[model samples]
Target: MAETKKTSATPTKVAKKEKMLRVTLVKSPIGYCKDQRQTAVALGLNKLNSSNELPDNSAVRGMIFKIKHLVRVEEI
Candidate 1:
């Protein structure tokens, strides 16, 4: 008779920690790219002096970088 071998179960994946960034609209979005305006809107910033807290992910960072002249970002 031959013996059978058993394998261990698959390991569980750990969820990554999500960081946050506080973004504030310091300048107007007038004359800015439509995409920039959209980004600001998505961030809940429609007017100057407005602010929002967003996830500190690549996509959000990219958006902030594009409108760095219009917004201020601080680590939360």
Candidate 2:
């Protein structure tokens, strides 16, 4: 006689979550150039020690890179 193994009929499903970014102004941009300062402002950080939660995308990431020295970033 031969024996066989049984498996479940339903397939496993996996859920995916969208990536997000938390950007905070860690340093003052007063001494920075106009473009850098404007970049920070465009990210919605108008004051020192301010933070904004934004989506993780190329445009936003590019903006962050522009003022990476003036701000802190965390993935959410």
Candidate 3:
């Protein structure tokens, strides 16, 4: 027979935390590829020097990578 382990009812200290990314539109997307422009816009960067705080996830990272030449990314 297998033995069962006892468990405590105490709450765990584990907490869910979301990382944030500080993205800024450092350069203009004009004359660039259409996809790059779209990506920049989707990231909430519509003007030069404009910044947006977004979740640090794969989707956001992908968008940033697509327009790396037109913007800058920093972790917060």
lDDT tens per residue, model 3, 1-76:
9999988889778878889999999999999889888898899998899999999989999899888888888999
- Cα displacement (angstroms), candidate 3, residue 47, comes to 0.7
Error of 1 at 9 (Å): 9.3
On residues 1-76, what C-alpha lDDT tens digit does candidate 2 reach at each position? 8988888898886876779999999999998799999999999999999999999999999999999999999999
Please, what is the whole-model Cα lDDT of each candidate in the order they appear? 0.89, 0.94, 0.91
Please tell me which predicted candidate would have the highest TM-score against the true structure: 3
- Backbone N/Cα/C clashes per model: 0, 0, 0
lDDT of 1 by residue, 13-32 (tens): 79977899999999998997
Pick the lDDT winner.
2
Model 2: C-alpha RMSD to truth? 6.4
Off by over 4 Å in 1: 1-17
Off by over 4 Å in 3: 1-15
TM-score per candidate:
0.71, 0.76, 0.79
Worst 10 residues of 1 by lDDT: 4-13
Lowest lDDT sum, 10 consecutive residues, model 3, at 8-17
